[model samples]
Target chain A: MCGALNPDELTLLSRHTRQIEHPSGEELVGESTRVEAYDNLMRGVVKLSKTLEDGRQQIVGLQFAPDLVGRLYAGESPMTAEAASDVEVCRVPRATLERLIERNPALRKRLMDQSLRELDEARDWMVTLGRKTAAEKVASLLLLIASHLDPEAAGERRIFDLPMSRLDMADYLGLTIETVSRQFSRLKKDGIITITANRHIEVLSLAKLQARCG
Target chain B: MCGALNPDELTLLSRHTRQIEHPSGEELVGESTRVEAYDNLMRGVVKLSKTLEDGRQQIVGLQFAPDLVGRLYAGESPMTAEAASDVEVCRVPRATLERLIERNPALRKRLMDQSLRELDEARDWMVTLGRKTAAEKVASLLLLIASHLDPEAAGERRIFDLPMSRLDMADYLGLTIETVSRQFSRLKKDGIITITANRHIEVLSLAKLQARCG
Candidate 1:
């Protein structure tokens, strides 16, 4: 979030872009699909996941607005990516992106910066996966969702909507759906959040959420 | 491993690098320490870890030779990096690296490619953390370490040494030390691997390991 590209940079980025949309439940990248084109998330959420032969599955990552999808220069995708919600993404062919990178030094630099930032996020998630408790996991996910929902409200304490379903949350956090529901109930009972209809969540105390995260 | 920068490209990668070596058990980037530099593992291995106030610890990652250690330009390190063994690293000052990027576009592209590769590895680890059993986790860790240890061994089945300790491996895999040890024993009993010592593990059945990974 710190090293965002300026208008000129954004214009340079737009040179390699094409738009495509995926409805909810659509697969963005399929199993055994060759990595033909990469995408930059323009709207909605996508989940990168894999399924086992026995039918168990795990959500590897959540790609949000402005997040880059697919391998930059790789020839194939190893996992499947599905639209967790309705998604609109800017598709950039690998060859075209390579040409753009080769032609524009500033564009290449910006991409380097973005890649480094994504690596930092990956390392942060490592902490989440390795150390955090189930309660902390849910808390961290909520906080993350809140921060992304409204960047303006990120610095200050404020509530935000959870865009994904409880099942999605369960898979993403490596917990059962029942555990996710129980955690939600616990949070609501503790006055950390208020749940309303249509899966709306109102964070009551960001401080309390942070405490639970720890 | 195939498309990564060559030795000559690696030489051109010099951008204000500082060489440092830490003996076993020394902490490099502890929690609360300012992450002023991005480190590349020139030799040996480092363990990235974190501990809660309650004394429970988790090992998030193991930085091996030729792996990049820190997130470039990160304002803070989310976990502590300690010497898993005696380790040698090339540390680059963040601002200096920025200046170098401004001057050299080709080098920036190379680094971006490196970061993207790391991002893929992290996502793979996310799946391991989310879905894999302890036995599968150890098996996956072995496969990863094998690839890093011997790129030439690709397309051929071979075993390799695990650089990290059982405790370190357990922490990284999000399992208790005893659990990790038990998984190793199970694998050994199943003829998946031959444990010569606590540190030396040789893969006896690569196909079995892969199947176990699934």
Candidate 2:
């Protein structure tokens, strides 16, 4: 991991950094566009997606708070990044970042660590997408969101607000909206979760949810 | 990418680095095991895979010559790294590699670049796993291998040897072996490719294969 940056390096980075906000469903970066800056998400979530020539789209990744937003060393964005919710991010121009990375070894190492972590997460998600059943995929996604929303929650029951819509959830989980909805209802009837109005979900039993994930 | 390490740093790394070989089908690193070293594949192909408790496995990524073999910062190996063909690697201890990264900025930048590249590839594969049909997936895999094996081949016909077996191809494409074989037959029947003995493949029409990938 990037160990630490000196004060001068930090000051140089801060001088080039600017904060920006986007509303829900806003496109942060369009696919194949020239990447101008790196955005570090300060709040809310973003979905990274790609679309085929025939208009089929797949949500490849979800970026949460503190996740870096752009690909480094690439001339153009490979996927479209859209704001899943109202989000705030600190943006640094790509040129400025490259300069900072050249001068600050710690920052470069940190970026490398971030990329490796993302790669690991992407590979894990491939397993879910390729091998898991629809039910298991939904359960895995819920568990992912629950843990991301509250990392310290270690109890029998937990609750979190769904950050994205059911349609987005279907895209992320590689299922149809009806299938996702049916699975949710099944989980609710099975007493594994309680879904209230406005996309609020309370996981009644972590054990049961994990069982469903299998 | 550790670009042009200083002579002293290079010597230091080389001192700790040793060439090792693994036979095809040998497991190099087991999942969840303690990672002790970093491997730089010098020859042949390797597959990084993960398996479920139910014994379902997915080949998440394929590493070819000159690709790094192990995750840097993580303690436990998240996926199993297996030799897809008889492979040789330059093995450097994790501690040594970390020290090299810390002391050599160029090496660190190179590594960071490598990680970012891998992340990009992983996201691309996620699209294939989540959205592509079985035939598309098989075509995509073929295209991937064809391009990797011979990037300079721009003609209508190209030939390359597949490093892995049908089972591995099925796992990587998220399809049954029967489906993969059937697709190959379909492609052959359609005059898209020719499958020779010893897993050799000749792509008759690259455009047709690309069309199938859609």
Candidate 3:
């Protein structure tokens, strides 16, 4: 997010950051809990989710490298953060980052812009979750993962490991796992995508996939 | 959102603002259209929506008096804003506000905080859209309106005009108009709410209404 940071600012940030690696499925931070560290993700993916008292879950957001994960202000995090894949993070103490942000307008503006972009993304997904058909939802999620995992590969076939499990995908899309799988099978039958070893996905055509996302 | 502005800053803001009044159903901003002004709402409600290519529309956000309604950064608006009721706004030139924000960190932080709050609300609504039942969706929307309309009336009956039409409610909840009407009737039959003139809604018991929001 701090893509505008100068070399001196980068050095200042590096002084406060400590690198850490986490395995998939690790809980980086719990919902409604205070956070002591603000993670600047260097690699891998993270999933943010909220759970109901009865255990129904909804994955609200997915974060990739260069995204920050923690409470921006104070109080407690409203969503839980979990590692969706083997992840690396440059974790900075919350207070240090907060102090730096207060002093550095560049840092403040970068974070603000990032938060606004995330807000826009969240609203877009609201349309997907609320209005999209089940099959469309599945395709949209696939398109999302494909686009983000290999953003530099525009208009090219996408091949990558699915960052999240099928169960997690079901939760994210507000569909049953069976329904998600059925959509995947339909997509495969239509020659739009291929799956191997369950997690590996190869999108045959971005155009065809976009059509399915409708 | 600039609640922390000093008297001098408020004076400066006033100098840059021109009051405007709009009737209900007016389009304050259109999706994908460039905006010359940023509106600082003075009274009434505004509904922001996104429409799909096939004409399916989803209400993404609702803004109240004291909220700003315009492009924060320089780009075409991603959503359409329509007046939910007769509304008043203090309109400021976009360039003026942008310049002021660039020069004032307080204003910047205020907008950032507001944006973050919006992000949280959007995610919360995602959970409602993804997991909550149709009945719960109806109840949750009612609760949201009641709470926002009269925050001081906690633990008491709530009486206010419904801001949006039943059709709009259906769009927001991702339900058919018939389903939304049926749910309202069910709530009325159960003595949880009373609707008059198809617009005035009197929540009989906020506690019972909240219980239904689950």
State every prediction's TM-score relative to the real structure. Answer: 0.85, 0.96, 0.94
In candidate 2, the residue pairs with backbone N, CA or C atoms under 3 Å apart (3 or more residues apart, or in different chains) clash, namely: B1-B110
DockQ of 1: 0.57
Report the lDDT of model 3 for residue B136.
Answer: 93
Question: Residue B28 CA error for candidate 1 (Å)?
Answer: 2.8
- Which residue ranges in model 3 land beyond 4 Å of their true spot? A1-3, A6-12, A154-156, B1-15
Candidate order, TM-score descending? 2, 3, 1
Error of 2 at A202 (Å): 1.2
Q: Write the per-residue lDDT of candidate 2 for residues A75-133, one digit (tens) a residue.
A: 99999999999999988888887887777666666677778888899999999998999
lDDT of 3 by residue, A1-214 (tens): 5576778778888898889999999989999998788999889889999998789999999988798987598579999999999999989888888878887877787788789888888989989988999999999999898877778886749998887889999999998899999999999999999999999999998899998777
lDDT of 1 by residue, A90-162 (tens): 8877776676667666556566766666666766776777777889999999988887886686443666667
Candidate 3 at A24: error in angstroms?
A: 0.7
Candidate 3: the clashing residue pairs are none
DockQ: which is higher, 1 or 2? 2
For the candidates in turn, chain A alone yields TM-scores of: 0.85, 0.94, 0.92
Give per-residue lDDT, candidate 3, residue A183: 92
